[model samples]
Target: MTVETIGWNTAQRRGFGELIARSWSDAGLRLRYEREPAEVLAEYDIHLAAGTTAPALPPSPGELVVETFNAAEAVPPPPCMLSICFCLQPDVKR
Candidate 1:
Protein backbone atom coordinates (compact mmCIF):
# COMPACT_ATOMS: atom_id res chain seq x y z
CA MET A 1 0.00 0.00 0.00
CA THR A 2 1.04 3.56 -0.66
CA VAL A 3 1.24 5.33 2.66
CA GLU A 4 1.37 9.12 2.83
CA THR A 5 1.69 11.19 5.94
CA ILE A 6 0.67 14.80 6.01
CA GLY A 7 3.65 17.11 6.46
CA TRP A 8 2.87 18.98 9.60
CA ASN A 9 4.96 22.00 10.45
CA THR A 10 6.14 22.65 13.99
CA ALA A 11 3.31 25.08 14.66
CA GLN A 12 0.73 22.69 13.28
CA ARG A 13 2.12 19.87 15.34
CA ARG A 14 1.96 22.01 18.46
CA GLY A 15 -1.62 22.94 17.69
CA PHE A 16 -2.48 19.31 17.11
CA GLY A 17 -0.92 18.33 20.42
CA GLU A 18 -3.04 20.90 22.19
CA LEU A 19 -6.14 19.81 20.33
CA ILE A 20 -5.56 16.24 21.42
CA ALA A 21 -5.37 17.21 25.06
CA ARG A 22 -8.55 19.25 24.83
CA SER A 23 -10.49 16.55 23.01
CA TRP A 24 -9.43 13.97 25.58
CA SER A 25 -11.18 15.94 28.29
CA ASP A 26 -14.14 17.25 26.33
CA ALA A 27 -16.87 14.83 25.35
CA GLY A 28 -18.61 17.30 23.02
CA LEU A 29 -15.46 17.96 21.07
CA ARG A 30 -14.84 14.25 20.72
CA LEU A 31 -18.37 13.74 19.42
CA ARG A 32 -17.92 16.52 16.89
CA TYR A 33 -14.66 14.96 15.76
CA GLU A 34 -16.36 11.62 15.23
CA ARG A 35 -19.08 13.24 13.11
CA GLU A 36 -16.97 15.83 11.24
CA PRO A 37 -13.31 15.18 11.74
CA ALA A 38 -12.30 17.52 8.96
CA GLU A 39 -14.25 20.37 10.47
CA VAL A 40 -12.73 19.74 13.87
CA LEU A 41 -9.24 19.60 12.43
CA ALA A 42 -9.77 22.80 10.48
CA GLU A 43 -10.17 24.67 13.74
CA TYR A 44 -6.47 23.94 14.24
CA ASP A 45 -5.72 25.00 10.65
CA ILE A 46 -5.09 21.40 9.62
CA HIS A 47 -6.76 20.65 6.31
CA LEU A 48 -6.73 17.49 4.27
CA ALA A 49 -6.53 17.36 0.49
CA ALA A 50 -9.65 17.15 -1.62
CA GLY A 51 -11.15 13.67 -1.79
CA THR A 52 -9.15 12.72 1.29
CA THR A 53 -11.17 11.15 4.07
CA ALA A 54 -10.76 12.43 7.58
CA PRO A 55 -9.68 9.74 10.00
CA ALA A 56 -11.52 8.85 13.18
CA LEU A 57 -9.97 9.18 16.59
CA PRO A 58 -8.83 6.17 18.58
CA PRO A 59 -11.14 4.66 21.21
CA SER A 60 -9.13 6.45 23.91
CA PRO A 61 -6.57 9.22 23.87
CA GLY A 62 -2.89 8.31 23.75
CA GLU A 63 -1.12 9.86 20.77
CA LEU A 64 -1.88 11.78 17.56
CA VAL A 65 -0.69 10.31 14.30
CA VAL A 66 -2.47 10.40 10.96
CA GLU A 67 -1.49 8.24 8.05
CA THR A 68 -3.28 7.74 4.73
CA PHE A 69 -3.03 4.61 2.68
CA ASN A 70 -3.77 4.42 -1.03
CA ALA A 71 -4.58 0.90 -2.11
CA ALA A 72 -5.67 1.62 -5.69
CA GLU A 73 -2.11 2.05 -6.92
CA ALA A 74 -0.60 -0.56 -4.65
CA VAL A 75 -1.30 -4.24 -4.82
CA PRO A 76 -2.80 -6.28 -1.96
CA PRO A 77 -4.77 -4.99 1.04
CA PRO A 78 -8.49 -5.63 0.58
CA PRO A 79 -9.74 -2.17 1.53
CA CYS A 80 -7.94 1.17 1.86
CA MET A 81 -7.86 2.72 5.29
CA LEU A 82 -6.68 5.80 7.17
CA SER A 83 -4.77 5.35 10.43
CA ILE A 84 -4.90 7.81 13.29
CA CYS A 85 -2.88 6.68 16.25
CA PHE A 86 -0.85 7.83 19.28
CA CYS A 87 -1.67 10.52 21.79
CA LEU A 88 0.10 13.57 23.15
CA GLN A 89 1.03 12.83 26.69
CA PRO A 90 2.89 15.01 29.14
CA ASP A 91 5.56 13.04 30.99
CA VAL A 92 3.39 10.13 31.97
CA LYS A 93 5.28 6.97 32.82
CA ARG A 94 4.71 4.07 30.52
Candidate 2:
Protein backbone atom coordinates (compact mmCIF):
# COMPACT_ATOMS: atom_id res chain seq x y z
CA MET A 1 0.00 0.00 0.00
CA THR A 2 1.21 3.53 -0.70
CA VAL A 3 0.26 6.80 0.97
CA GLU A 4 0.48 10.42 -0.16
CA THR A 5 1.61 13.31 2.02
CA ILE A 6 1.33 17.05 1.50
CA GLY A 7 3.23 19.81 3.28
CA TRP A 8 2.11 23.42 3.40
CA ASN A 9 3.74 26.49 4.82
CA THR A 10 2.19 28.09 7.89
CA ALA A 11 0.95 31.07 5.90
CA GLN A 12 -0.29 28.88 3.05
CA ARG A 13 -2.23 26.42 5.21
CA ARG A 14 -5.51 28.36 5.23
CA GLY A 15 -5.47 29.16 1.54
CA PHE A 16 -4.56 25.61 0.58
CA GLY A 17 -7.08 23.98 2.90
CA GLU A 18 -9.84 26.29 1.72
CA LEU A 19 -9.11 25.58 -1.91
CA ILE A 20 -9.07 21.82 -1.32
CA ALA A 21 -12.09 21.70 0.97
CA ARG A 22 -14.01 23.70 -1.61
CA SER A 23 -13.41 21.01 -4.21
CA TRP A 24 -12.56 17.83 -2.35
CA SER A 25 -14.74 15.26 -0.59
CA ASP A 26 -14.34 13.17 2.61
CA ALA A 27 -11.19 11.44 1.53
CA GLY A 28 -9.95 8.49 3.61
CA LEU A 29 -6.64 10.21 4.07
CA ARG A 30 -5.05 10.94 7.43
CA LEU A 31 -3.38 14.18 8.39
CA ARG A 32 -0.02 13.88 10.12
CA TYR A 33 1.15 17.18 11.47
CA GLU A 34 4.80 18.08 11.76
CA ARG A 35 6.58 21.22 12.80
CA GLU A 36 8.98 23.26 10.64
CA PRO A 37 7.32 22.64 7.26
CA ALA A 38 3.90 22.09 8.79
CA GLU A 39 3.13 18.99 6.74
CA VAL A 40 0.07 16.80 6.28
CA LEU A 41 0.55 13.12 5.49
CA ALA A 42 -2.15 11.52 3.35
CA GLU A 43 -2.19 7.77 2.88
CA TYR A 44 -3.56 5.98 -0.14
CA ASP A 45 -5.03 2.51 -0.76
CA ILE A 46 -2.22 1.79 -3.13
CA HIS A 47 0.15 -1.00 -2.11
CA LEU A 48 3.56 -2.42 -2.95
CA ALA A 49 3.67 -6.15 -2.34
CA ALA A 50 6.55 -7.18 -4.57
CA GLY A 51 8.16 -3.79 -5.07
CA THR A 52 9.81 -1.33 -2.71
CA THR A 53 7.77 1.25 -0.82
CA ALA A 54 8.62 4.66 0.61
CA PRO A 55 8.50 5.94 4.21
CA ALA A 56 6.04 8.52 5.57
CA LEU A 57 7.44 9.48 8.92
CA PRO A 58 9.99 11.88 10.45
CA PRO A 59 10.32 12.41 6.73
CA SER A 60 13.95 13.23 5.95
CA PRO A 61 16.52 15.78 6.82
CA GLY A 62 16.40 18.93 4.65
CA GLU A 63 13.54 17.15 2.79
CA LEU A 64 10.48 15.04 3.72
CA VAL A 65 9.57 11.54 2.56
CA VAL A 66 7.02 8.75 2.96
CA GLU A 67 7.92 6.39 5.82
CA THR A 68 7.07 2.83 4.84
CA PHE A 69 7.78 -0.20 7.02
CA ASN A 70 8.55 -3.53 5.41
CA ALA A 71 4.95 -4.66 5.73
CA ALA A 72 3.53 -1.19 5.70
CA GLU A 73 1.62 -0.38 2.54
CA ALA A 74 -0.03 2.90 1.65
CA VAL A 75 -3.73 3.18 0.99
CA PRO A 76 -5.46 6.15 -0.56
CA PRO A 77 -7.83 7.70 1.94
CA PRO A 78 -11.51 8.13 1.14
CA PRO A 79 -12.04 10.98 -1.29
CA CYS A 80 -13.90 13.99 0.03
CA MET A 81 -17.38 14.52 -1.40
CA LEU A 82 -16.90 18.27 -1.49
CA SER A 83 -14.56 19.86 -3.93
CA ILE A 84 -12.61 21.63 -1.19
CA CYS A 85 -12.13 21.97 2.58
CA PHE A 86 -14.49 24.46 4.19
CA CYS A 87 -11.98 26.86 5.71
CA LEU A 88 -13.49 28.48 8.79
CA GLN A 89 -10.77 31.02 9.24
CA PRO A 90 -11.88 34.32 10.71
CA ASP A 91 -10.72 36.13 7.60
CA VAL A 92 -12.06 33.47 5.21
CA LYS A 93 -15.79 33.01 5.46
CA ARG A 94 -18.02 31.90 2.62
Candidate 3:
Protein backbone atom coordinates (compact mmCIF):
# COMPACT_ATOMS: atom_id res chain seq x y z
CA MET A 1 0.00 0.00 0.00
CA THR A 2 3.02 2.26 0.09
CA VAL A 3 4.57 3.67 -3.07
CA GLU A 4 8.08 4.88 -3.66
CA THR A 5 10.38 5.54 -6.64
CA ILE A 6 13.33 3.17 -7.13
CA GLY A 7 16.30 2.89 -9.47
CA TRP A 8 17.67 -0.21 -11.24
CA ASN A 9 20.53 -2.70 -10.68
CA THR A 10 21.33 -6.39 -11.31
CA ALA A 11 20.86 -7.75 -7.78
CA GLN A 12 17.66 -5.83 -7.36
CA ARG A 13 16.35 -7.01 -10.70
CA ARG A 14 17.00 -10.64 -9.85
CA GLY A 15 15.40 -10.24 -6.45
CA PHE A 16 12.40 -8.57 -7.97
CA GLY A 17 12.00 -11.41 -10.43
CA GLU A 18 12.00 -13.87 -7.58
CA LEU A 19 9.50 -11.77 -5.68
CA ILE A 20 7.20 -11.57 -8.70
CA ALA A 21 7.33 -15.32 -9.09
CA ARG A 22 6.63 -15.87 -5.43
CA SER A 23 3.85 -13.31 -5.23
CA TRP A 24 2.07 -14.66 -8.25
CA SER A 25 2.37 -18.21 -7.00
CA ASP A 26 1.18 -17.30 -3.53
CA ALA A 27 -1.81 -15.50 -5.00
CA GLY A 28 -2.53 -18.34 -7.39
CA LEU A 29 -2.16 -15.98 -10.31
CA ARG A 30 -0.26 -16.85 -13.43
CA LEU A 31 2.07 -14.39 -15.11
CA ARG A 32 2.93 -14.52 -18.77
CA TYR A 33 6.12 -12.69 -19.52
CA GLU A 34 6.73 -10.84 -22.75
CA ARG A 35 10.42 -10.96 -22.00
CA GLU A 36 12.69 -12.50 -19.39
CA PRO A 37 13.86 -10.24 -16.55
CA ALA A 38 17.40 -9.82 -17.80
CA GLU A 39 16.31 -9.17 -21.34
CA VAL A 40 13.61 -6.71 -20.27
CA LEU A 41 15.98 -4.78 -18.05
CA ALA A 42 18.62 -4.67 -20.69
CA GLU A 43 16.29 -3.61 -23.48
CA TYR A 44 12.82 -2.40 -22.53
CA ASP A 45 11.18 0.24 -20.41
CA ILE A 46 9.17 -0.79 -17.35
CA HIS A 47 5.54 0.29 -17.36
CA LEU A 48 3.32 0.38 -14.28
CA ALA A 49 -0.43 0.84 -14.50
CA ALA A 50 -2.36 1.53 -11.30
CA GLY A 51 -5.80 0.64 -12.58
CA THR A 52 -5.75 -1.85 -15.37
CA THR A 53 -5.18 -5.52 -16.13
CA ALA A 54 -3.68 -4.82 -19.51
CA PRO A 55 0.13 -4.55 -19.47
CA ALA A 56 1.46 -1.11 -20.33
CA LEU A 57 4.39 -0.72 -22.72
CA PRO A 58 6.97 1.62 -24.30
CA PRO A 59 6.85 5.42 -24.89
CA SER A 60 6.37 5.84 -21.10
CA PRO A 61 8.91 7.44 -18.84
CA GLY A 62 11.44 5.81 -16.40
CA GLU A 63 13.18 2.46 -16.78
CA LEU A 64 9.87 0.65 -16.36
CA VAL A 65 6.56 0.87 -14.56
CA VAL A 66 5.14 -1.91 -12.40
CA GLU A 67 1.51 -2.64 -13.14
CA THR A 68 -1.18 -3.74 -10.70
CA PHE A 69 -4.93 -3.86 -10.38
CA ASN A 70 -6.45 -0.71 -8.98
CA ALA A 71 -9.07 -2.56 -7.02
CA ALA A 72 -8.55 -2.82 -3.27
CA GLU A 73 -9.52 -6.49 -3.29
CA ALA A 74 -6.88 -7.41 -5.80
CA VAL A 75 -3.44 -8.55 -4.74
CA PRO A 76 -0.82 -7.11 -7.08
CA PRO A 77 2.01 -9.18 -8.37
CA PRO A 78 5.42 -7.71 -7.50
CA PRO A 79 6.74 -5.22 -10.03
CA CYS A 80 8.82 -6.77 -12.77
CA MET A 81 11.67 -4.40 -12.15
CA LEU A 82 11.29 -3.79 -8.44
CA SER A 83 14.65 -5.27 -7.51
CA ILE A 84 16.38 -3.16 -10.13
CA CYS A 85 14.78 -0.04 -8.72
CA PHE A 86 15.63 -1.10 -5.19
CA CYS A 87 19.26 -1.44 -6.15
CA LEU A 88 19.33 2.08 -7.48
CA GLN A 89 18.17 3.46 -4.14
CA PRO A 90 20.47 3.90 -1.18
CA ASP A 91 19.98 1.48 1.65
CA VAL A 92 17.90 3.21 4.30
CA LYS A 93 16.54 1.87 7.52
CA ARG A 94 12.86 2.44 7.92
Candidate 4:
Protein backbone atom coordinates (compact mmCIF):
# COMPACT_ATOMS: atom_id res chain seq x y z
CA MET A 1 0.00 0.00 0.00
CA THR A 2 1.05 3.59 -0.64
CA VAL A 3 0.29 6.51 1.65
CA GLU A 4 -0.24 10.12 0.63
CA THR A 5 -1.07 13.29 2.55
CA ILE A 6 -3.29 16.03 1.15
CA GLY A 7 -3.06 19.57 2.41
CA TRP A 8 -6.16 21.01 4.04
CA ASN A 9 -8.14 23.50 1.97
CA THR A 10 -11.74 24.17 1.06
CA ALA A 11 -11.41 23.29 -2.59
CA GLN A 12 -9.13 20.36 -1.97
CA ARG A 13 -11.38 18.91 0.73
CA ARG A 14 -14.46 19.11 -1.46
CA GLY A 15 -12.66 17.59 -4.41
CA PHE A 16 -11.17 14.84 -2.28
CA GLY A 17 -14.53 13.88 -0.84
CA GLU A 18 -16.08 13.75 -4.25
CA LEU A 19 -13.26 11.62 -5.58
CA ILE A 20 -13.64 9.18 -2.70
CA ALA A 21 -17.37 8.87 -3.22
CA ARG A 22 -16.87 8.16 -6.87
CA SER A 23 -14.20 5.60 -6.19
CA TRP A 24 -16.38 3.76 -3.72
CA SER A 25 -19.33 3.74 -6.06
CA ASP A 26 -17.26 2.45 -8.93
CA ALA A 27 -15.54 -0.21 -6.89
CA GLY A 28 -18.74 -1.54 -5.33
CA LEU A 29 -17.30 -0.84 -1.91
CA ARG A 30 -18.47 1.27 0.99
CA LEU A 31 -16.53 4.22 2.42
CA ARG A 32 -16.16 4.14 6.19
CA TYR A 33 -15.05 7.04 8.36
CA GLU A 34 -13.43 6.70 11.74
CA ARG A 35 -15.15 9.78 13.12
CA GLU A 36 -17.25 12.75 12.22
CA PRO A 37 -15.54 15.91 11.00
CA ALA A 38 -16.66 18.22 13.78
CA GLU A 39 -13.39 19.89 14.77
CA VAL A 40 -11.50 22.82 13.35
CA LEU A 41 -8.57 20.58 12.58
CA ALA A 42 -10.44 17.30 12.36
CA GLU A 43 -8.68 14.19 11.15
CA TYR A 44 -10.63 11.40 9.47
CA ASP A 45 -9.81 7.90 8.42
CA ILE A 46 -11.57 6.41 5.41
CA HIS A 47 -11.45 2.67 5.08
CA LEU A 48 -12.26 0.87 1.83
CA ALA A 49 -12.40 -2.76 0.88
CA ALA A 50 -13.03 -5.00 -2.16
CA GLY A 51 -16.45 -6.35 -1.32
CA THR A 52 -20.07 -5.40 -0.70
CA THR A 53 -22.22 -2.60 -2.15
CA ALA A 54 -23.89 -1.29 0.95
CA PRO A 55 -24.22 2.41 1.65
CA ALA A 56 -21.09 4.17 2.86
CA LEU A 57 -20.61 4.04 6.63
CA PRO A 58 -18.09 3.72 9.43
CA PRO A 59 -15.91 0.66 9.86
CA SER A 60 -17.48 -2.30 11.64
CA PRO A 61 -15.06 -5.21 11.79
CA GLY A 62 -12.45 -6.93 9.60
CA GLU A 63 -12.15 -3.80 7.51
CA LEU A 64 -9.20 -1.82 6.28
CA VAL A 65 -6.90 -0.22 8.82
CA VAL A 66 -5.30 3.18 8.25
CA GLU A 67 -2.61 4.52 10.53
CA THR A 68 -0.05 7.28 10.73
CA PHE A 69 2.92 5.25 11.94
CA ASN A 70 5.40 8.06 11.35
CA ALA A 71 3.38 10.98 12.52
CA ALA A 72 6.17 12.31 14.74
CA GLU A 73 8.46 12.87 11.78
CA ALA A 74 5.74 14.18 9.53
CA VAL A 75 4.82 17.79 8.99
CA PRO A 76 1.47 18.91 10.36
CA PRO A 77 -1.14 20.66 8.30
CA PRO A 78 -2.12 24.27 8.77
CA PRO A 79 -4.52 25.24 11.55
CA CYS A 80 -8.28 25.28 11.10
CA MET A 81 -7.99 22.64 8.40
CA LEU A 82 -8.72 18.95 7.89
CA SER A 83 -6.43 16.06 7.11
CA ILE A 84 -7.12 12.57 5.70
CA CYS A 85 -5.18 9.47 4.82
CA PHE A 86 -5.66 7.90 1.40
CA CYS A 87 -4.36 4.33 1.09
CA LEU A 88 -3.94 3.15 -2.47
CA GLN A 89 -3.19 -0.30 -3.74
CA PRO A 90 0.10 -1.11 -5.37
CA ASP A 91 0.35 -1.44 -9.12
CA VAL A 92 0.66 -4.99 -10.31
CA LYS A 93 1.32 -6.71 -13.62
CA ARG A 94 -1.06 -9.24 -15.06
Best by TM-score: 1
RMSD of each: 12.9, 18.2, 16.9, 15.9
Estimate, for each residue in 1-94, the C-alpha lDDT of model 1 and write its tens digit.
1113566677766666666666766789889888887888888787877877765554554543344445476576544233433334445431
lDDT of each: 0.61, 0.32, 0.36, 0.35
Tens-digit lDDT track for model 4 on 41-82?
A: 122233323342212332333333444344457577423222
Clashes of 3: 12
lDDT of 3 by residue, 1-94 (tens): 2112344455544544544443343332222244333333332233334442323221223344434444466477445544433222224321
By summed lDDT, which 10 consecutive residues of candidate 3 come out lowest? Answer: 52-61
What residue runs in model 3 are displaced by over 4 Å at the alpha carbon? Answer: 1-5, 28-94
Candidate 3 or 1, higher TM-score: 1
The per-residue C-alpha lDDT of model 1 at residue 39 equals 83
**lDDT preference between candidates 1 and 4, better one:** 1
Instruction: Give the true-structure RMSD of model 1.
Output: 12.9
Misplaced by over 4 Å in model 4 are 1-5, 28-94
Q: Model 3 — TM-score against the truth?
A: 0.24
Q: After superposition, how far is residue 80 of candidate 2 from its true place, in Å?
A: 16
Q: Which residue pairs show collisions in model 1? A: 62-87, 63-86, 63-87, 64-86, 64-87
